[model samples]
Target: MILDVSALLSGKVDVLEFDYIIPLLDEEGEATILPPPDVDFTSGIHICGRITDNAGYMALKASCEIGYRTACARCLTDLEGTFCYEFEKIAAKAGTIEGDEDNYVMITEGRLDLDRDVAEEVSLEFPTRFLCSEECLGLCPKCGKNRNLEPCDCANQKEIDPRLAILQKLLENQ
Candidate 1:
């Protein structure tokens, strides 16, 4: 996962290949999901695009895909899906370099780790919600039952305003 850049800095153009499984982590460094899922990452990083003393900076490009199991938004059932993303990173040897929101990575001491970078990129692309089916009827609010199994008569019940009900009750009592 870690690639040494001494040769590239010494005027050599080498493409390093890396493939590995990365573990997803939450903000606190704890495993984001229990039974930690595996992520597949593959990429070819260039020590230098062209061999030259003036080879400015190293270029990194990687592709990653991850499978996620999440609860359905409507019915709360488990749903599985695959997410794929591509990343391009640049390592500057001269001064400090900053990247935009989508493409951002830092190289320190002329070394870079592809597995870590790819894992982070893939994690950022995870979907917020998952759905088993688009047409899920969801659960009934009144009876707290699943609406997909059967239609409840509560949906057809007429609603009376509280004020009207009170007036009707008073008239009947009189």
Candidate 2:
């Protein structure tokens, strides 16, 4: 679950390889279909990259693929997508990184929690919106029905002001 980067700092390198199912719980500890309920996350990482002696920091490159299910924002259909991210991390203790926050990964007590890190990165990679299809017809507002399943004319009707009723009739006849 975690690897001590302190060992790498001392030239005693160690690697972390793990596969596990992580629960996606909401603020109320309830399961959300937005990210599905449970997901299997497998990670095979080699932390063999160098730990700078002068700074007692690690510069490691990680390549990982995380798969999860997310409901389409428009169609409310379950869709699965894999997030593949390869990034270089300069890991150090939380308080050590001064100016460049983007270049650092915080290790608590010299231990890097790979599971948490992978989840964070993968979650961040998720698209802001998921669509079942590019031409998907969304739900209807008036009847609260899925337009994709059944087409509705209510959503396509043009609204006219009450004051323009007489003018609308004249236009309709024309």
Candidate 3:
């Protein structure tokens, strides 16, 4: 999906609006973000926003919405949600604005690959961690029990270094 931003670059168009979805699947129909192998990305990733012809540069601002069914990152609790992430990326032609080139999505020959560009932005801007709650007690590392469901004392014991284990043994004997 290549977008012709020529008009916006020429200062003839004030804004260019866009709304579309990118299927979160590869050629084989498998989901994009995988490994859990159960995450539901059937609805695909939706991107909707506008490109404003600012006084000097074009501002590409958009929001990405992802709906998925998966387990919590820390605890293995099942959950589902529609997450929205908002981001703004500058689109400028070569040598017009000065500074770091990486800051802006470089406009090449007045054309922009909207699909690829927006997808990159979505991946970079979206949150990787999907938690059930801010203070969710995850599973205990030693006991492999869900701390939220089953409280454990495994977290209370302090791990001693091998060199310090001798001192701990001496204290225990005393």
Candidate 4:
């Protein structure tokens, strides 16, 4: 959504607050970033923040939270959680800021469009890997079984080089 900052920009207001929800879809009502089947993105994202006019420039502090149904990467265990991201940017009238323009969000026509910025920051912070626990046993490579679910009798030893057969024989004789 595009927010009008006319009052704040004109010195009529010192701060502008915003609270709203942004759909997870793109301009065409479809997703630009898709999560795995185990992760749900239907609930959308909630954002709340304020823009303070710090005399010459506006300081934007915003936070967004998204609800998700996730799964472990190794075991595929379902999980329900909410993830939050915080964004801060300096805003100045269009063409006012000089040099490092990339670090600031330039306001054009007394308006602020946070949709693109929020989408980008949230997408970058999205989880690429999920785990049920820190010490997840994962799945067994041999029998294609979940080692954490049950014990397997498969050999867990590593094979030695055949060139060391004489050393094995000597050790056995000892």
Candidate 5:
């Protein structure tokens, strides 16, 4: 999303409100976990922020919600989720601000491009793992069967640790 800050830059408007939706995509041009495949983001980024000019610096406080789909890490079932994040950013007019590169965005030509910022925020809010349920049985390691569907007869025997096998052999010899 692009915002024209000409009025803010010229001291005409002290604050501006912005709201939009941004589509999230991976490098392969496919819908990513940020927006997921089920959530529709074609309308653009759903953002609402107040842009204010503080002295000569522009500050933006925004919040957004992004819906996405992911697979259960244990059961591999598709699941839908939402990611929400809020950010506050400060920008200076081109070369006017220096230092603290992490906290500042440089506004050039009186325009602010929020595409990258929104993407980053969504990514940061993404869950590291997904689970269909708290008690997901996952899959059987030996048979590759989903334990949640049905119980497998695979032996529940615990293999002896290799390091302790030598002691077992010594005991058998004695």
Candidate 6:
């Protein structure tokens, strides 16, 4: 979605209330457009916020939510969750602000493109690791099986570190 900030830029409007929907995928296809890795956005993002002119600079405050599906990082089970967050940003006319790029966005042609910002915010808010539950048993390294579902014989085997083989030989000689 594109927001025209000409009125705010020109000082004609001090504040603008906005409510819009950002589509997660192309309308014609099932593929995701722009989302964090392994995440499937199941619904359009709903955003509601307001933009105000702060001494010639545009300040934005918004809250958004979207339904998403992903897999558990440990057990690889499908999980569903909602991505939600509230954000604030200061946008200046292109080339006006300096230093950190993440502090604010650059407005071009008196318009702010929300697509990139929304995607970035969603990615930042997404969890780096997902778990089906706090106490998930995860998978067995020896037999590559899900330990939560069933027990594996590999769990009964003792694993010896290869680096300690010399010590084992010394003990056997004694």
lDDT of each: 0.53, 0.56, 0.71, 0.75, 0.69, 0.76
Candidate 6: regions farther than 4 A off: 26-33, 139-174
Worst 10 residues of 3 by lDDT: 33-42
Give per-residue lDDT, candidate 4, residue 6.
94
Query: Which has the better TM-score: candidate 3, or candidate 6?
Result: 6
Provide the TM-score for each candidate, comma-separated: 0.56, 0.49, 0.63, 0.76, 0.66, 0.68
The candidate with the higher TM-score, 2 or 5, is 5
**Stretches > 4 Å off in candidate 3:** 25-40, 94-99, 135-174
lDDT of 2 by residue, 1-174 (tens): 456666655566544333434345535775322342443333322222333433444566666555556666665767676656666777777787789776677878867765555556656665566677877766655554677898877546687455555543553343
- List, residue by residue over 26-82, the lDDT tens digit for candidate 5: 456865334433333333346788888888767888997766567777767777766
Please, what are the lDDT tens digits per residue for candidate 1 over residues 44-139? 221222212234555666666666656666656666666666666665553475445344455557675555555555556656565667777665
Compare the candidates by TM-score and give the number of the best one.
Answer: 4
Worst 10 residues of 6 by lDDT: 165-174
On lDDT, the leading prediction is 6
Clashing pairs in 3: none
Error of 4 at 87 (Å): 1.8
Candidate scoring better on TM-score of 1 and 2: 1
Residue 124 lDDT (model 5): 65
Candidate 5's C-alpha lDDT? 0.69
lDDT of 5 at 9: 86
State the lDDT of candidate 3 residue by residue for 43-110, as single tens digits: 66788888898696678898888787777777879988886788788888756768766557777798
RMSD (Cα, Å) of candidate 4?
7.7
